[model samples]
Target: MTLVRDIREDDAQDWRRLWAGYNDFYEASVPTEVTEYTWRRLLDPTSSLIGRIAEIDARVVGFSVSVLHDSSWTSSPICYLEDLFVDPSLRSGGVGRALIQDLVDLGRARGWSRLYWHTQANNQRARRLYDAFVEADDFVRYRLTL
Candidate 1:
């Protein structure tokens, strides 16, 4: 069975491996400095970023990061799934699904109004899995780099 739990200090190497795979899947590259900063933030209790790693037989094979944010539309908070990654070899083995379910449970426990995420339109496989939960939003996303 796959076990899911909060990311621990000793899992840095495995986290980096999965993080590299995640970046490769999106064809994006993050600087080592930025990655180190993020790693530190995730482990910091004061940081808003919360991460969970999935382990199968004590080896980390997947991870997810989520953040809780205040929403004007509701008095309670909403949970945004910032990043989720499962080793390519472990895809379709319920690791991703379990991570997502864990996030949902967390949101429910915290009284979050919504749990949402976005994926590239070209990611048909992920879309297929996501579709089983909720339909895509009609709005488009735009980013402005500072």
Candidate 2:
């Protein structure tokens, strides 16, 4: 059975491996220094970032990061799933689903009004899994680099 829990300081190596896999999946590169900074932030109590790791047989195989923010449209807070990644070898083993379900539970416990995430339009596998739980919105996203 797969288990999901909040990320701990001792799971640094496992977190790094998952982080690298996440970046590789998107064909993106992140500097080691930046990754270290992010890792520290995730573990910092003063930081808003919250992370959870999925483990099976004591081995971490996936992770998800979420952030809570106050929404202008709603008085309650919103939980935004910023990142989620599962090891390719462990796909379809319910790890991802467990992580997401955990996130949903967390949101509910915290009185969050909404929990949402986005992925590449062409990510068919992720989309398939996501569609099972929620419908895609009609809006398009645009980004402007500073």
Scored against the true structure, residue 128 in model 2 reaches a CA lDDT of 85
Residue ranges of candidate 2 with Cα displaced over 4 Å? none
Global lDDT of model 1 = 0.92
lDDT of 2 at 97: 89
- Given candidate 2, what's the lDDT at residue 104? 91
Residue pairs whose backbone atoms clash in candidate 1:
none
Which pairs in model 2 have colliding backbones?
none
Q: Mind giving the per-residue lDDT tens digits that candidate 1 earns over 1-146?
A: 88989999999999999999999999999999999999998899888888899999998999998887888999998888999999999899899888988888888887889999999999998888888888998989999999
Model 2 over residues 1-146: C-alpha lDDT tens digits?
88999889999999999899899899999899999988998899778888899999999999999887888999998889999999999898788889999999988998899999999999999988898889999989899979
Candidate 2 has an lDDT of 0.91
Task: Please report how far candidate 2 places residue 78 from its true position, in Å.
Answer: 0.8
Off by over 4 Å in 1: none
Query: How much is 101 displaced in model 2, in angstroms?
Result: 0.5
